[model samples]
Target: MFHTESDVVFVKGLTVEAVIGVYAWERAITQPLLIDIALETDISRAAISDNVNDALNYKAVCDDVSAWCQAIKAQLLEHLAGQIADKLLAKYSCHKITLSVAKPTASSKRIRLGCRSRVMQRSSKISQL
Candidate 1:
């Protein structure tokens, strides 16, 4: 596999509220969500040019994620994570990305839920005859 160095872009502790779980009680109310995302891309151009356009605008990414989450409610954390990963891949052109979503305190007798997910993407090149 090939690897590329990104500009170390990340979004930490982005809090949001969503309904996610597998139990009846879990679905009854919304819960706080913490999201962390890391993107891998060559940011040299942006660094050299000193232009925001040349870099991956993290705010845009966050807005997109928030909107998508608000629009589509998921019953499981796995599904929610997958949705975010897929959306980022489709919306952004990057070599790799990792996303994690956590419920903080979902293990209580009242809550009883916890989930996290991570994904990575790689670039591929093929020889044309």
Candidate 2:
């Protein structure tokens, strides 16, 4: 039972360089990683007002993601993806979130390694504290 006005706002292909992974070589050097984020929320207020403030602050989301990514070192893309989703849920008012993390194929030894994570929750039920 979802409303038609419920939409997912997103920012994709946000590339940043960070020290990530378990390997010593990986820790010594930074690598370019890309992130895609989707946040689901009711956009009726924003639609009516046509105000950026009334909508999800996408620039703020990107800033938070960048800061979080730089602050932590994760051994796996799955962990990073989960962290991103959790941060979004905790920081913003949203019904659901989906995050994807991708690293270049040439950089990692693992075959086609990437991660995607999704979280769904009711906004009314979420506690602000």
Measured with C-alpha atoms, the lDDT of residue 128 in candidate 1 is 23
lDDT of 1 at 95: 59
Tens-digit lDDT string for candidate 1 (17-60) = 87777788877888887888887767788778899899898889
Error of 2 at 93 (Å): 1.1
- Number of clashes found in candidate 1: 1
Give TM-scores for every candidate, taking all chains together and pairing residue i with residue i: 0.78, 0.83
What does the lDDT come to for candidate 2?
A: 0.80
Q: Which residue pairs does candidate 1 place in steric collision? A: 106-113
Number of backbone clashes in candidate 2: 0
* Prediction-by-prediction clash tally: 1, 0
| lDDT per residue (tens digit) for residues 64-120 in model 2 | 998888777787887777777878888998888988888874345665457788887
**Residue pairs clashing, model 2:** none
